[model samples]
Target: MPKLTIDGIEIEVEAGTSVLQACEALGIEVPRFCYHERLSVAGNCRMCLVDMERAPKPVASCCMPVGEGMVIRTDTERVRKARNGVMEFLLINHPLDCPICDQGGECDLQDQAVAYGKNTSRYDENKRAVKNKEFGPLIKTVMTRCIHCTRCIRFAEEIAGVPVLGATYRGENMEVGTYVEKTLDSELSGNLVDICPVGALTSKPYAFHARPWELRKFESIDAMDAVGSNIRVDVRGGQVMRVLPRLNEAVNEEWISDKTRHAVDGLMKRRLDKPYVRGADGKLKAASWDEAFAAIAKRVAGLDGSKIGAIAGNQADAESMLLLKELMQSLGVASIDCRQDGAKLDATTRAGYLFNTTIAGIEQADAVLLIGTNPRKEAAIINARLRKRWTMGGFPVGVIGPQIDLTYDHSYLGAGPQSLEALLKGEGEFAAKLKAAQRPMIIVGMGALTRADGAQVLAAARQLAEQVGAVAEGWNGFNVLHTAAARVGGLDLGLVPAAGGRDVAGILDGADKGEVEVVYLLGADEIDASRLGKAFVIYQGHHGDVGAHHADVILPGAAYTEKEGTYVNTEGRVQRGRKAAFAPGDAREDWAILRALSAHLAKTLPYDDLASVRRRLVEVNPAFAHVDDVAPSAWGAFGAAGAMDAAPFVTAIDNFYQTCAISRASATMAECTEAFVKGRQEEGKTGTHG
Candidate 1:
């Protein structure tokens, strides 16, 4: 460690810690356009220049490592002059269109200019201009506003690992643009807009929206946090202003998907504002909450708890999850499940109490075997890590998935029941390599397995480990990708009713067979209603979707934004999710509804708040014993659980904008979908199925 003084404050930091970091540690603010916490230090902008006691000239602080007894002055006259000169140079070509610019109120350049720049420049020369190039739908660019800090370029080259963006000219003539105006094809392309230091790059949709001061920030989770993530939402006038990563280090870290950032608009879209019921006329009709609940109670009263089933979607909050389980148990239904039938099964004992093996721990594994899932399309961040593991030698990545997912970057494809045998038997060169490697990992998620037959895959994965001697004793080797923010936690709570049906499909089939008198849709969907018969359906969710369309009764529910709950991550870490806003309209938390309905029937479930439910979670599932103790906002480094870390790198995730409901509704993603369809037609494989 080295001791350094920055802005008259002294602090000790690791020998390798940059002076800028030391300054940050000592609570000294240094303004710079190019420097980011994650990216490599360039020191190109010169805005971080500081006057050091020994150095004759000011030095850029971002690239300078801390040294013993180094004294630095960031606001001295000499340092101020240097920074002001640099700022003057930066403003020469800048458009200075702060009023109409999307990044106006929040632009780092504007702030720095006000703080470090002189009132005017000495040069009377013409400002250089560069041609604007079309990047893609999500981001807009005005090349004249670029400061050449290369934050966006570095983010593209290093973080995202896509060469779509780069500086195209010499020195002052340099411009940030794509090669030949080709579409910015990277899945994580939208992030460039967030990182650009000036008004050069902006979010196309957010342009001309309310200024930054007009928006309010809210801390919330995403639809995926059912998988355990904490995120922040910037809202203005009851609508989402933007989405940014909240530092939790455990789940999402200081990173999030375009989906999590943009999907917030779903709260205002096609919402179920009022209660509804299906009529004899075969259409859903608006009804009072009392009328709907009464009908549900009457129908539920006729059923045996053993014949009932409930399924919860991964997007619902933990409160909603607990409520649904209570309702089912009261109705004597134990066949509750969220597993997608017929894909894969996770019989690894504590199936739902799973998290990402600590967010980037997969990067450290000497070997990775992906069984039946596409990280790129579904779990983008994980896929990005796996890609780095594969491409940059972070590790040798192996795939046993149903498809040749591009995220594997260098994958050996295997599928069916035989997929596991290949790794066990070392049938191919890829499998042989994976078998011979140490620190091997098997990640199982959506595609290879669902709630249906995912157990078979898990069995095969375990068998492969046993046969190949790949798994280390007492360590997590087989990882199942969980779906919700608190899916792991909810499952840990043993919220699955004792008498519910086997799965949703089983209940639907029972409904088809007239065995179930009334079907309760508990925060669940993803079924094609066209396959089921005329059984009474009850839908409970924030969104009005196909399930609500077929419902005999409907109940509006609170989204993750309006609920307080605790989630157990797949890594078995407990996280608290607090409410950041109110329910939209006539909407109740899932647990509230279950509590009301349970009280109505004169029964009580043994828990009160999110904390109490978590206690029951630990009681029912001993696998989650540590969950009650982990703090909600706590996060650990990747591979901190005796695991290796990924490279000093970040992988751009899948098309986040395309995955979320709001972005899906955006014309941008729709255009991409159409283009994809066209490409499929061009490939002459329009109807191919995997």
Candidate 2:
């Protein structure tokens, strides 16, 4: 421990603790621009200069290490003059555009300048102007206001692992951008806007929108992916202006994907604002709630319970899924499934389908083996964590799927089930590495569990995990990376078929063969609607997507942002998302819709409100009783056995931007697909960077 005195206050800190950190511990403030707690220390700003006893003059506190009996004075005259000089130099090149700047209310530079900078400038020389650069459709750049903090550069190299951004020139001629003109290819590019200290980089979709003060903020959970990232929704007049990342170390640590941040536009577009029913003309027409309910009742009236089926979508919350399950059970309907991707998941045990080694636990892993999963697209934040782990050294990763850049160094094991079988037999060098590691991880994905031989693949993965001690007494590292935000929650609620019921494939097959009569889609849009044949489809969702397109009745329901609901992440952690904005006109909450329809069907559910519905959820599964807590599932046998096939494994997510109904309806997401997905494909064809 090193003892230090700052402003006549004495304190002891860790050996490697910096003076700036020591000052902050004693309730003293240090102004900094290029310093972020999560990022590496870069003392380039010189804004945190502090006077030291028995020293030459002032030193950068952010990089200055504390010593035994070191005296630091942060409120002295020399420190004040040094900070003022640094602030003046920063303001000299900074453009006077805060009035129209998007970062006006919440900018770090704006606040620090007012407190530390002089009242007026002394020089009258013409201000330097730099040309703005493009960083794709998601980020709007104004390089003229840049302070050269290099936060974005470090974030690209360390966090995103893209290394596409860098300083091009030296000194006064320096500019931060790609060496060649191109949009940032990282899925985490939107974080640059959040890390920048000034208005140099702002959200392109959110440009010229409402300021921070004008928007009403609501803390919520993001439903874009299975990470269940903590987020804050900014609403202006009942409209979602933007979504920003909230700090939660157990989950997403102050960062969100571009889709999570920019997909608010989809909430206002292509919304199912009113109930609709297919008339005698075979066209959907606006109808009252009673009429829509009647339409569903008319089709399901004398139909056999075995002929009725329900499918939950990716964004379906726990409350609605529970009510839907109860309603179906009461109606004697056994055909139901939440695995719209037709994944062969064994919901019998919670550990079989959860990320057993929680997101934070990735840092503790020594070896990792990815089986038919692309964490970069499926869960960008998880990939960032894996990169962070890899950067610490002594961590080795092996991939057993399609070769893609995971933003880290990983060995490419063979492509399919044969490679997995080989590892089980201890026939590879990577398998030897897995056996030698203390805490090894094996992550299974949809690509391995959505095929004809999915059960066999799952059994093999479990056997490999058991053989390599991945699932042991103290630590269980066998994980399943899910792409849907609702999959874990739906499974936790036992939304699978009853003992005599069929899975998703069997339900769809029965529908095509005239064995199934009524199909209820609870926001399920990813399934093949064409295969429903003559089945009367009833779609209850917030978007007019594919499921609604083929529906016989559309009962408009609330989106994630329009309702208070619970969602479980891939780690089986229960999280609750609050209602940020109201659903469009005539649309109601999902659980309320199901509760109302239950009465029409003569099978009224007991729960009347959200609280009652959540209580019922806890009864269905005790895991729902603890919100924001991860109750580790007891590790046991996966109980799956079959023969392995030689087919090559494919990547689960084809397009990262347009995965679900909301993102498919987003114009901003569409633009990203054009500039990133399609543009990259075009670039690949020409062998040139765009």
TM-score of each: 0.86, 0.99
Alpha-carbon error at 504 in model 1, in Å? 1.9
Clashes of each: 36, 0
**Candidate number with greatest lDDT:** 2
lDDT of 1 by residue, 1-690 (tens): 778777777788888998888888877899988899877677888889988887989988999888999998888889888988999888887875788888887788888899888897788888877777776656778888888888887776665666667777688877778756565655566678778888888877567877888877877656643335567767776566666767764455555654565456556677777888777787788888777777777776656776556667656555566667666766667777654233333223452224434555665567777666556655555555565556667576666644443534556554554656556667777777666766667766655445334444456666665555554553445566654444565555554435334666677777788776566666565565654576777788777666676777888887666776655655566656556667777887777777666765557666666667656555655554554343222121111112111111111123434543334445645665554434445556656421
**Candidate 2: which stretches are off by over 4 Å?**
none
lDDT of candidate model 1 versus the reference: 0.64
Clashes of 2: 0
